[model samples]
Target: MPQFDSDPVFCSLLQGSSDSRGSFSIDMMDYSHSEQSYIRNSPVLVTVLHDKYGNSAQITDFAPRFKQYGRVFCPVMTIRQIKPLNGSPRICVRLRPIYEYGAAIPQITHGSNHVRYVGPDMILRLTTNYSINAILDEIPVVLDEGVTLILGPDETVPDSVTEVGQQFLNQTLDYWHDWTRSLAIPYEWQQEVIRAAITLKLNAFEDTGAIIAAMTTSIPESPDSGRNWDYRYCWLRDGYFVVSTLNRLGTTQTMEKYIRYLINISANSENNFLWPVYRINGMRNMEEQIVESLAGYRSMGPVRVGNQAAEQIQNDVYGDAILATAHVFFDERLEKPGDEVLFRILENLGEKAIEVYDKPDAGPWEFRATKRVHTYSSVMCWAACDRLARIAHHLGLDNRYEYWNSQAKDMHKLIYERSWNEKLNSFVGSFDGNELDASLLLLNELDFLEKNDPKFASTVDAIGEHLKEGNFLFRYIAKDDFGEPEYAFTICTFWYIDALTSLGRKQEARELFEELLSCANHLGLMSEHINPEDREMWGNYPQTYSMVGIINSAIRLSTSWSDAL
Candidate 1:
């Protein structure tokens, strides 16, 4: 039996195959698309097999059966010998490309000492290693005679394509391994963080280096509702967290590339007054369009592409961008003085923060219908001003230090008083509403209050009691108009981890942190939410913000634990 250090779920799914010689364990997981049938119709079949000989087999029968073990069914596919090899048997499996319209058959091929295949609509070539051939050759010999078998409605490809699919799966595993090995996370949760971190990076669009909010989009926030939205674009508010996390992990290359992307987008935008919340390839004209022609995930209506929030006023973004840039400057350990362009950018942001810090804007959530003075937004505004002041002081730039400092102080003071709901004994979501926000947990890290401060401690307890669900935490209580979302924000859990560490509850913090880490999928990847009931990953895959949380929490836990020891 071959051992796999990656994606055990996939490994187990592929291990189900039986041969005349008994059963052999292949490395792969089979993920059903039925749960999310709207976005994709076909299930995903992944496996790792050894193919020493060029000879391989094709998929002959494919079926899915739902059992008591799990909500989703097991995928069964038959394989037939296509050719015989003198050396080792080849490994392979088949997959149907599930899209909105229907399924599409994909062609499989081999090249460059590996297997290569292309689905008609695939954006990139799928490749795999030679080891998978052995798995392909061991399929039940009865199924190897090219017999047709029952397949699901969503299934389009025949069993003959199994070899190609196996090839791609093997290649994918190799690609993931190579990518994971390249990352250098020195934190104590290095192994765990590295796995999650690599997944986040893989989800990034290679050409633009823009990390998508998640991997698969349109996973309904509600059941069979029109709540699905594409999360495949970049969000400025998340950029700082992503970059800072990568920096802490010593993976600066991708973050640097992302910084360049940010610079280009910010520099070239025609309407700086309205910074888009997301854009594809830095294009600001991101119009929200529904693919009415195709079904949504789980038959959820109106699968949307492009985010309308792109045009909304998210003032926190300005602060997040500045904070990320500052972190890059600080973490890179730059010895030289700050560049003129970078300094100018900071100065402009400081000026903007000073001007808009008092104004009510659509807060971080970008609530479409309401515009209020959200406390989290105010905090970030304060952060932007505070960071600028520190940068100016550090570089000895004789800019408006007094003005920036005064502005930051005023913002802080406002949040302390106006943003607090004294009656509830917790910080409110906004000045207009009494809802508590999990984002307030960021106060300690932002230095708004010491971790042990009575107010901060109370706030933490308040969030734990009001906003937490088991080990997971929601972003905030649902507003009257906005329905409650299904997924727990992964980053918020990490924030809680950081908060715990800051409060000197290192053991508790480490335990909670480990629990959160365990929420990741078999590949060490996380989505926006982990279904509390089933604990399966929901929302997008490979979320950068979630990975950022993993990295930062690990850093805090390791550093603090080491110091205590």
Candidate 2:
């Protein structure tokens, strides 16, 4: 029903169409392969253009098609568009790169490197490796008749400088097929798992190992309105889960790259104070700025470019980074080199944690106006100390053992005593107040309490009563002055699955896991949150935290299911 006046180049590449219910249906087979898996499998961006009779045209294209948008040039491989026979005012377009030399070409190829379609009110143009001059050449052709032109490069392209793109494509597919087939887990949920895995991989910027929180920036929390923020940078808290999830899925190489990214970022700290987050290229200063000129997604006002929270002292990051590194060391059987710089970094973190452990700072949520001694932050501090102590004991760093052990014990005691609210029968958000936080679920996962403990049960029950909405969970209760509460956080829902699994609620955990998996978009991507009423994704897209949650929950569910059998 809704339509665009003309299709933008970005929207003409989507591969699917919405049914009468407005539910988008996409075909995975047309877009999937292991080596090119992450790139080819993304949802085609779609835009609809309308004519005088209200007839709409659907435009779709892969993001890589916009290679000109980047400074580099790649080959154009494949681009195609389809329209409904009934003329429902929508056209479906799918674009991919041809990597294999002998691959079958559709009749639509039309024997030219570029293609153009002209209708009464709309003109569609798609070009590959066609010179920027050529692309620019066609713009006037469409605009002269008031027609719109959509254009971009195709994916899986070979290098424009070298003709090996076909060879690379073949090799990539072979590697992906072999690697995916080697997984120990059964593929009953293979389609979903592969889709999720590809989504996670795509979020990783290939040029830099730094994983972005999402691809697009400034998709508003409310409809074309408030709560716009950029998620293109790396959040240290997400690192632990992202690496852990990839490792669980048997993608050690990808996990290793992320570890390298971690090492690169962590090694840059000038003093004991490392940033809570960083830019994709390891830049420290991400001064938040509004892009006043461009209209945001759906006319969301004030398109933002940089993240302001990079400077904020989010205390949980210290623990999260250490915990993630420790998991990598443990899971990958990595030999601890006494001389590795990361070890020294851990030691420095331990020393810093001791100084700042008692201080009130921004917790995991990084609330703008308020700084509080958040319980989750303290719990993570305990976790950092615990990890450092264990690693030291394992590596025979006997000299540092006593100090770390003492600190860990002290933090554990403080969190248990001060962070718990006996009056509410739940763990409060911060030591200064009694508001329950969903993050307390981490207590069980951290093994701070036994699964069957009365306190743990009560805490879970309290969260279920207060925070759980249907199958999804909220991060925390709404605070009016803090910020807008937009949608249910995707990562929080996965955290719930993790917590439920730890508590031996295996059936409940699996059921919830399946339900959450259903929340993924057509390309198996997830945003930071989900709109409860409409089920549309909100917040950042292809969130690393959300994908990490999915992989972790899947592994947990599979392991538990196997043990029960």
Candidate 3:
């Protein structure tokens, strides 16, 4: 995506607060939003200590879901206290909510028990289990921990905070444990697979099944790189892989939601033409803009909202869109199982692919200053045709199948002639040059080349030799708009591991996969890139692509059920 900023704005929402530790007001925006501001009553946690001898410890304060029930089903936050060796502690709580994307702070009317936050758009009723006087008047009490605090209209709460917190934690633990048990995970590398699965599930907007590229935006790809681009939208290219991965895990819920989104966009687009990205709700018109109101992550300037890549022409989406939809035709359980109608709609995208795949447009990297027929983009175009043919054959449309198959064969032949670099003895990144891109490593995964093919093996070696930096891989070492990428692209590194395992380098691949898994944040989450030199996460948080890579690699490399058992 180009780093430009000029577009209409749709505001994003969140709630933030301030406390004694510096100021949560301006502090946590470290890599979060800075442009928008709001104020409302949110929960506050104050740990008050009542000493054994009436010498109470000083209370320190600070603070912090999906909609489900008739009332908002917000997150059930839990506070756990490890048994303190020293002081007896009590808990104090408060509630505040922000209004209008942080632009306007809400007014609070303190009540005997609850507080009603008067916001510009809507009214919020915040209920508390503690004494309103203690919360509002700064009174403190020592309480136990591990209690799950549920904030609803009229619910009973425990006097011992620990009891509630622990119950909440227990329920949450059991909830996720049950969910994971439903997953078709490999017996081996179970932990790594589960972590990746959790991340992937989190990345999807459950309400709409739209999988976002990452949670936070403007996290620099490299330190002070100014390459902060917002990735809070659905990219067809990314969505394709997300659907495929979820399908591999036997989870079709997201696939159905996402395709409904895709179909909406397809029908709305002019003549099946598509932008690379769209908002989760299938909003097509995104105006990229700068949020000067908030400081950028780590003080990087010009924090941006709305991605400009949505405007770029990334042709690989044709294959992506089709591949994502292929399941619809075959899956009987889906609401609108694939029919002639959907196939016709998808054909328009395939036709658009054939029209543009050979033409010059933004490739997957979306390099504006330079454009070329990216090998990956072309292969996806080929993939679109290939998948359409398969779907047609499956549906008993003999003529359509024959036509798509023939077209796919022709496109494949042309790509081989153009993208294959005889001199390098491997496929190159773009038709115009010889730069080795890690994306070319996807050749086997895409089935463009057979797994055992000598050509595919050579490409793996070519990309590995050139792109590997210790255990991580860069998208490409060649510099672009901002200059050479200083960090390793986390997804690409995982892709490298997948490539290694595919080429029969199981031991080496396994070692690298373990290293990549180690690079995740404490929560087993990963950002877009990594500072390979220091193993620090860079770019956006909990990137879907990186998490998908982890899942796919583990599944590919895990031992057979018999062996694992």
Candidate 4:
């Protein structure tokens, strides 16, 4: 690792392993909540240093978790001795903290088993059973299984760290295993579905019920592609799919939490327009920027931290936000049922949709260079009004239902008339355009069109012919400022599976779906993009949308429970 001590902090998983080291990232002013990867680097490090013979011990590191306490998640690293002899073994610890997105390295002081590091951004405390001098000096001292370290905002260090750590590790596993038991996983692909659900669950900020898009930033969509973006913030469009998948798997808790988040955003909006993305804490501003100090993943320059797209008008958000809350309006289990207040707020969004449905926008694909009246955005706008009409009907608000339904119908007519291209034999990407966009694959999904509709079949074929590269799919094949897309967007491929299943092309869909599953990492985790050629996973990791696709496709295609045996 390049030990440039200034603008960035270098980190590693194994305490003493230099080759395994990586750099830290944060949501710079431009890339809001950018460092969605791992939590900040630990100011406390512990490693075993062995003398000449090179015989030493090993330490296991993990955050203390499982049973949910009100506010206690102490990361504990347990060091244990292995079978070793003929050498003087020692352990080394270090405390170097770069805070404020690598702009500041904090001042440190120690007391007993604790070290306090204070910076302008935040305060951190390291609690361990080692000497402060040894930690700062980077000298490895001999250690054993009982050694332990925990870091947190609070300075309180428990008396018996080893005992408490062991207890935490045991209970945490039991807690997770027990929770996993409650999943309503499909008989087939049960393990895969459960794992995806667990990952998605981790993505939710329980404090606010906000589900982030992913947990990393500045990892390029492709090598040196300049498509590196912060996936930490929550986007209403992506969150809608995530909520639907969770709700389908009988995990209504996340949906319930996300619905409340939706209501809160709507209540606070100055205009009826809903932002496509927001910080998990519900703070609205997300100005994106690039961090100059840190060399990016693989030392790629121009690592970005924030996401500026939060300000851009992506019209699909209104529909998604409304659809996100549709569950509570019908599910009697809700504590506070949807009322006229919510309907009125939705109507405000519906009006905004009608006003902007025909206007140009950044659209769901978030094209950076130019705006277009994307067919997908218009269809989603139609969905917003259409769902509002359904909710209004459910609430017995007949007038509201008629009003929203009329608006939805008009938008529907406008969309088909302008988007369909006779010559291309498919619905184009935008009004009066001839480009095929995979997002149009969502037509049947949004119920804008039925699978049996000849038009739907033709459009699917058109996208398959042009936008697909082997089994994987692209958002669109067109070139942009960065150049043509280098890999397949994994979620679009899932959308294709949904369409094929709906069309009763189960064999084709299953083959492709199986291939997609095989593309996941060894742990069955997926990201936003896939290198279709090499079948390597790329983009931000633990992608909620991609996992949502897995859960949804499995549900749509899994066999009867008897086969699970």
TM-scores for every predicted model: 0.71, 0.74, 0.82, 0.86
Off by over 4 Å in 2: 1-168, 182-188, 332-341, 480-484, 559-565
* Per-model CA lDDT versus the true structure: 0.59, 0.61, 0.70, 0.74
When 1 and 4 are scored with lDDT, the better candidate is 4
Greater-lDDT candidate between 1 and 2 = 2
Number of the top candidate by lDDT? 4
Compared with the true structure, what per-residue lDDT tens digits does model 3 show for residues 95-186? 43443323455576766555555656555443444555654454545543322223332233435544544444444445555556677888
Residue-level lDDT tens digits of model 2 in 439-514? 8887878767778888888888888888887887888867734355657878888888888888789899988888
Candidate 4 lDDT tens digits, 266-358: 888888768888888776766788876456666654566678788787888888887888877888866788888878877888888888888
Of the two candidates 3 and 4, the one with more favorable TM-score, higher being better, is: 4
Error of 1 at 323 (Å): 0.4
Model 3: CA > 4 A from native: 1-87, 90-103, 117-119, 122-125, 131-141, 144-175, 331-336
TM-score of 1: 0.71
Q: Which ten residues in a row have the lowest lDDT in candidate 2?
A: 1-10
Worst 10 residues of 3 by lDDT: 21-30
Model 4 residue 530 lDDT score = 95
Better of 2 and 4 by lDDT: 4
The list of candidate 4 runs beyond 4 A from truth reads 1-61, 64-96, 130-134, 141-143, 562-565
